[model samples]
Structures are given as C-alpha cells and as structure tokens.
Target: MYAQVNATNSNSYIERYKAILLQHPEFTPFSWGSNTIYIDTEYTLYDVDKNGIPELIVKEDRSKYYIYSFNGTDVISSDVCYWSYDECLYEYEGNGIAIHDGGMGNMRIENVSLYSMVNNKLVWSGELMSTEECSSFDELYSFLDSLTPINDFLPITDYSHLSN
Candidate 1:
C-alpha cells in the first residue's frame, strides 16, 4: 500500500506516520510464493468526541482497524470485524448486463453491503453495491458522510435506549 501525508504539516503526526511507513517496508505489498499480499493503508483525522483535535484511525487489510492519537505515534486501540457475504441478482430498470462465462448476460440486481473500518470497528452497515457505476472510494465516502455523530453515550434518563 502507498502512503501520503498532508504536505502542510511538516512536523505533524501524519509526517511521522509516513516516515514510519517508509522505514517499515513491510507496510508495502510483498509476494509470498507467487501469492501477493497487499497491505492497504488508510488514515483519517476525525473528531470522535467533538473535541476539535481529530483522532486518527488507520485501516489495514482483513477488515482490521487501529485507533491512534493525532500525534501519530501512539496506538490507542484496535478492533477487527469479518467481511464476507453474498447477494442475489435480478433484472431491474436502468440496469445493464454483462456476459458471464461468455453466455447469456445477467444484470446486477441486489446490493449487498461491504465492510470497512469506521472509528475502530469494521462496519458493514453501508451499501456495498449500487445500480450506478462508481468507484469504491465514492461509496466509502458516502458511507463515511452518513455516519451519525456520537453526541451522548450515556444518558442518565434511561439505559433501555442503548439496545442498538
């Protein structure tokens, strides 16, 4: 996987993260007996608690997620979630078909959500497939934007509402 740090912050946490990534060549893709293993890396600065300074979340392969401070040095925590499923297909309006096995074509129909890291967990709560053609980043961005802010975790009035 490739890494990019914000150029504006020369001595920022992102820079350090990039430096570490560069030094540790293991972060890049490596071949193990002809089977290639990719190390997908991602970074984000978000205010999980609305504390102004953003907390960092680093994403890796196999739906693994790590939470780190913005300083980019210390790892706070990590969470892993499984990502695998199947969705049925059917015909629909405005849908196109592709020839599978060089035979009669089948149009993509049902959409199955895929998993990606959110906060520190691999969440499969977003739409993975859509009728429209778009990049995975576009879908991931839409999902990220749709996340609800964690305002109040512990409400004194009731605990039954925490059944989510």
Candidate 2:
C-alpha cells in the first residue's frame, strides 16, 4: 500500500491506499504502487535517495533488479537484468534510482552523490550533504526544518484514527 498527498489546495490533503492503523494520523497509510518485486527472501521498498518518492526494490533471489523510472514515471519493463552481486543478507546497495534536480530539471541517480547530471551528461554539481549532517533526532529535525523549498518537503501529520 502507498500514501497520497495533494497540496494543490489551500488545505492539504492526505490519504492511504489500504491498511489499518492504530489511532494516529501518522499511522495513516499512503497510496503506493500495487506492483511488487521479489528480491532476497523479503520484498523491499526503497526511497532510493531518501526522498519522499519511493520505488520497489525488486529482488530475485540472489540477483538485483530495479523498477526503472523516467521523469518520475515507471517504465514499462518486464525483463530483469543482473544489476549487481550480493554482499549483504537482504539489502542490496546501489540497486535503486533517485530523482534529482540538477539546477535545471529532474534527473535519476543510482546513488546519492555530491555530483549529478548536467547537459544530459554526468558532471560535478555539488556535495549532497550540507553542514547539518544527520547525527541525532534533533539534528534530523533541524535538517528537515532547514529545507527552504516548501513543496520539496512532505507534511507529516499526526491524526486520530477517527473517521469522517
């Protein structure tokens, strides 16, 4: 299941695909893709670059596969290719894509780096990490607060399980 949030209106909207939550708005499920990929012994959903957008980390036993995306749209693919060899138990690093705005538009990356694409080619952009590196809960909150661009950040609400 996934979650959906529409901020187009003055009053932001949020909804969940399917799932039961305890009693908090934070427990509300978000709309997500129904498609899944099998990797290792467990199905893993990765945010790719820790951004809000996520992609299914399809794992096929011992191999790694990615649900490719282009401009935030999942590419229609049915073939699985050898992305990398396994080095961990159930997690495969460098096996997903992330969208980045390279001072122009959005670009995809397998790994978050200090550099990103430029002019349709990979080039040095800038370090991804800021001075506020995530170290503690307070730091995380501070980093989150530091995000200037409002739309880039998602609203995290704590709502009661009470229905409308």
Clashes of each: 0, 10
lDDT of 1 by residue, 71-94 (tens): 233333334322221111111112
- lDDT of candidate 2 over 1-164, digit per residue (tens): 21222233321211220121111133222233985543322223333333343333333344433231112322222233343333221211343232222122253212222322222122334434332344554553354344332122111222222122
* lDDT of the candidates, in the order given: 0.36, 0.28
Q: What is the lDDT of candidate 2?
A: 0.28
TM-score of each: 0.31, 0.25
Point out the worst 10-residue segment of candidate 1 by lDDT.
94-103
